[model samples]
Target: MSSPLTLAPATGGQRPRRLLVVLGGALIVATYLFLVTVQPAEIAGGMGSVASLVTLFGFLGGGALLVAGILPMLSTSSLVVMPLGIALNIAIGQIAGSLGMQIYLDAIGTVLVAVLAGPAAGAATGALSNAIWGLFNPFALPFAAGAALIGLLAGLAARYGAFRRVYLAPVAGLVVGAIGGLVAAPVAVFMFGAAGTFGTNAIIAVFRSMGDKLLVAATKQGLLSDSLDKIVVFVVVALIVYALPPRAVRQFPFARTHRVLGGRTGALPAPSPVKAAHGGGSGVA
Candidate 1:
């Protein structure tokens, strides 16, 4: 059998590229904060479209920079996988929202990309997912920062072998969910006045009725919603990834390099001498 395709070894520029990814993610979050806090409240009424435009462009630009940094590292498989991830996120998230479910399983694709690619690609996927989804649902725009956080954390969790077992995935998801809630709470409360799905609003109202502050109530609601959603999402992602053919999983350079799926050390098998003689070499797939 032919050897699996292998990515190039780490290069000196990897650090700089990673730095760019960090900067891009930060910029996206920063833009979100600026709009929510710095912009006048009037923007909510007369300038809502403009504000939405700013959010869309902010995420788009940040995503661009992030994608540029990871471009070299991405395999052809990743290119194909990203769109699938985006589609899954939008379709499932919309369905959940329409049903007014308590949890939004929107970040499944984001977590999947992070597992297969890396933190940067995962973050970009989340940011861009919201930006694109914003076209159909503007409410999703403000939460791009939170989405990016989920992607970043999920990728980090996978890098550290969180997906090595089925149970560990939910633990990682819980951690990601908390951080995501922290980031999303302010956006939801300040921008939309805690407006969300029926279940989400009901949770916030319960907290409010219990004498919790508005922000605090919204925060609790976010924590509960995000944490529960991520647990299911992470578990689902783990199962889906593990169910994939090993050969297909191995196509992801990040997964192979980090042994994310917990297999034989991700070491590439020796190339066939005959293929080598014919100038055939492994390429990123």
Candidate 2:
């Protein structure tokens, strides 16, 4: 596997250095796109709107920075595992939908990236997961920021000893779920105009029927729906880590967080299944 840490971001060969330079250039362009766009960015090319240019620039620029931010910490193993994370977010996410479950169960890949790598890697994974998912379903683009939040928070919680004890796992889940819900509410409002996304929109519509304002109803749905989904996501991640053999766990980026390595073995965990390989996809711009 490729251990990027050994390559040294600042020192390594010219190739690695060039990679950072290119990523940096993309970031610069992304900024201009964001600020200079003539209109608000929209889906489906924005039909010649400057927002379309922003979306393109922003996607490439922001994505490059997000991934490159984790380059130094990524092992070849971590890199291999990244695509798998995106695959899980897309595939299993549908299973939950197919079953008509209230929870999303979509962040499986996001959580995986976090657990194996550090929060940065996990953040990259989460953001990319949504972007990839968007490729097939443009409606998914607005939620990239939300997914990124899920991954970052989950990874940070794990980093800080959240997974060290069995009891703490669920607590972490609730926290992540609440935050994910809050973050997603605005995105839903932006895309669907307070009707919310499909799965949770039903709930949002109910809230609206009850006389809630557009943003309020959407936020309420987010709190309820996202909370349930992310709680499930976090808890499952914990469980997966708990069940993993030390060797399997060790190869991941955040292996040090495992209670097995941290001198505890009795912590409760939530969920995940590591297949180690899968195809990839993007969400929206």
Candidate 3:
């Protein structure tokens, strides 16, 4: 018995704003790509190895991801990309076994952006920002795909009646995050050097060396505990996104537009008229 929902066409005035937003997003993406691919390799040895050099590149990459997450809040079209980017980066980190510099960068950026904006915007920005960064790293392919999927699923949740009710956002995030984990598990295992003859042994050896005594003890004592930590983190993020205030959420460059129901039909209200130099209407009038 319920009527089918329909979206209204955007008004003419909104076109310029939308165009500017798209252009800005493209520029951000381009700049991020350059930083990820050309800049890092040029400045450092692809991955930062030297102490001071590593720190510098680390700061730069982290700053770029943070900016990407924050910038999208300015426009609705691009706001959701952050979460997608974040989800993708998380998958990549989990899959790689050895968390790279990019993971820290993304984590810091995502947490900061999510705290500032709501979880939805935070998640979107996180996803898109990481996706852009991933373009430069072959290891990121699986994560990027996963991030894209999460973004799409979250958007769908927002569009549906029951899911958009704020309280359900965390549930939405959990479902999406779980799906991301499932998809990334096999890809991660492969990427973690399990693809070749000695890959599994090699990876285990590497883990042994990296983990050392403390890590080994921790792993042996409670693998489930470590996994629970990760799940808790994801759920916390989802809850944060859901609970963020509208005003706070609006601060993000990628903020979603509030859909006003039963407002004036058709287009948005026109801009107020400007007075002429002579006080009366101008030539155009």
Candidate 4:
């Protein structure tokens, strides 16, 4: 019979790093909330472009801090994956937006990173992707928080075995997308005044025509588009993961440590009797 795997507790040294990640994530959320809710005269008046810049920098700073915290914890392989993930998010997201697809396929790379690296790294990827994309596409700036949340949630889902079965990934995605929509609605209503991508804008316009308030319309549109987008993204990521060679899959420390893909998990073997006799057995049973 195969031994049951147990996740080791975080070491004392890791606690500080974990704290840094939490603080950085908190900073991102706080900055976004301040911008959306306060609507400072500087931002609300004639300086909309400045607001976009602020949003970009705020999210970028937070993401950079989070990545700093997560750097020591990542494997070299995971580090290599980050840039590719960012590129994937930008390239696919731009294409989908250009095509006027209602569902944003932007989070595929974020989810992919989250599933492979862990939540913190995934969150960093999502936040960074939006910050960089915002440089060229100002529209993406306001949604950085939502993107980060999606990444964080995707990693958590993977950690909890959401990817263990094919069907469960979509279910997890559905939940993540619903929450993402909630996170995004205020940005749509307050920042853009119901303006968004083609599909979402059309949906919001239809809702408005039907007598829904802007906030209500934005929220509904977000729910519809985000949920569908996430379901598709998660399914695609699952297929990609499954298609990878077992050796490739095992290279991801997060996946192997957590048994996310259900293999041997690479836990250290128990000492042999002879070795134990020569050296004492480690206290672990």
Candidate 5:
């Protein structure tokens, strides 16, 4: 069998790269905070409230998400960190609006990053993403926890090699999502108590007020429906990422460095002379 591929040995240069990763992570956190604290209220009040101003901001948020999706591909560490940031925004958005579909997308992104990296990085991304949402919106704490759990579970699945197969992606997401729902249920009961029932009713009422068409849209295309859709989307994204070249995967800035490949001890063993000769002799005379 061929030897495993190995990355170059570490150098002091890693510190600067690490610093960049930290800074990038910090920037993501800040952007999420702004989105959570500022953007939603603006969107709710009406995009036209400030005329073109709010619309401009909405465009900015969309642009940010696109950039974020692309950024994780820039480097190994970034692959993890950038996705963590996206996951945070997704969790907060899900909680704030009960947009289950968005949460699913975030979960997918988390799993992709984790699989490319490893579990600890995945868990960190998951935990931190949910934690940030929790801090921003107390009402979302349960969902935040759920989102984090989904990330963690997805990471675990990836670690065990369960997600390497495209066909298993949706199954893995469904299993992970069910676990997340279980984690969120008790918390919802504890925190919202009967209020959650009332809250759901209130949401239904609001949808009703918007008319049957809107209500149907909300129910069919909203949180619960979106959650299911997200599962499908997550699975698809996982499949696509799985098919990508490792070098392409490595391009993401948030991609995690595999722990096995991170240290000097794990460096690829030098090829034996016989094997090298058989494969292709070294150009050296």
Candidate 6:
């Protein structure tokens, strides 16, 4: 894939970005009011706050910014990877919170896309995944920015060769998780009031029982859960990369960049030469 700095094109190659920029500016004013005035009077889980309502509007603004990244990163290859990424997110995401665990397996696919492609593609995978999540449950709308951040950071980590060594994967994940936690904290506090489906919410409840501020409790919970989730995700992706055949893996944009072709490039064995020949050397062919 091209450098993340290599923007493909603006929406309509230009016009939409201009419009979004204007919309985003307006949303910023709303967000300020929400955080400054609205959040203070909130009772946990109560649905009454013009400021918080404005923050929800900010989620749309955040989504627009996230989507804006996709246009420049969008390509046929990214489109190809995106469906699989979303599927991975949906499928593994379901595996989460079973038996009351805090982990979310959702971002495996998003990180996979980021490593194979770049931040823009990864960002698309994340944004689209949450957009789909909103179809199943509207509560996911606020966390879209957090998901996008995860994908973006994973792509940036891969671009810098974090996947080259097995050990470095979690380090990358940690970074992604830390930033993701910060992004998600505000969403959970102002939008959802720290209520959630997993055991992480139990942790929030624990903090709340201790009289912790809602924002502080939510931030702590997000940091613990999101970081742990992403650490597992990065490590899992590393193992998957190790197990994949080089030829099969090479179709991705970051294949060469990720060193998936050799130890110098994190390469692994492919099908035998004869096997490839008999298969007409056509990987997807």
Per-residue alpha-carbon lDDT of candidate 3 for residues 208-284, written as tens digits (9 for 90 to 100): 56753322322222232223333444444445555655444444432333321111111233344664444755332
Candidate 5 lDDT trough over 10 residues, lowest sum: 258-267
lDDT of 3 at 11: 52
Q: Name model 3 segments beyond 4 Å from true.
A: 1-128, 131-138, 161-170, 194-234, 238-245, 250-285
Rank all candidate structures by their TM-score, best first, as comma-separated numbers: 6, 4, 1, 2, 5, 3
**Predicted structure with the largest lDDT when compared to the true one:** 1
Q: Could you report the Cα RMSD, in angstroms, for every candidate shown?
A: 7.1, 11.6, 16.2, 8.1, 13.6, 8.0
TM-score of each: 0.74, 0.69, 0.35, 0.75, 0.46, 0.76
Give the runs in model 5 whose Cα sits over 4 Å from its true position: 1-104, 142-144, 194-230, 250-285
Better of 2 and 6 by lDDT: 6
Clashes of each: 0, 27, 31, 0, 20, 5
By lDDT, the candidates rank as 1, 4, 6, 2, 5, 3
Off by over 4 Å in 6: 1-48, 95-102, 258-285
Where model 1 places Cα greater than 4 Å from the true spot, the runs are 1-19, 27-73, 94-102, 264-285
Give the per-residue lDDT digits (tens) of candidate 1, residues 1-285. 987699767766544477677777777778767765675644323535555566656655666667667665665677788887889898887888788865678899999998998786787688778878989998887677678778889999999999989999999999899888877876675566678878789898899889886667888988888888899999999999888877777778889889898963344666778878888866332
Per-candidate local distance difference test: 0.78, 0.65, 0.40, 0.77, 0.46, 0.74
Candidate that beats the other on TM-score, 4 or 6, i.e. the better one: 6
lDDT of 1: 0.78
Residue 103, candidate 4: C-alpha displacement in angstroms: 3.4
**What are the per-residue Cα lDDT tens digits for candidate 5 across 105-193?**
54555565555555445544554555455566555543443444455466677656555556666676666655554334333333343
| Candidate 4 positional error at 77, Å | 2.3
Colliding pairs, model 1: none
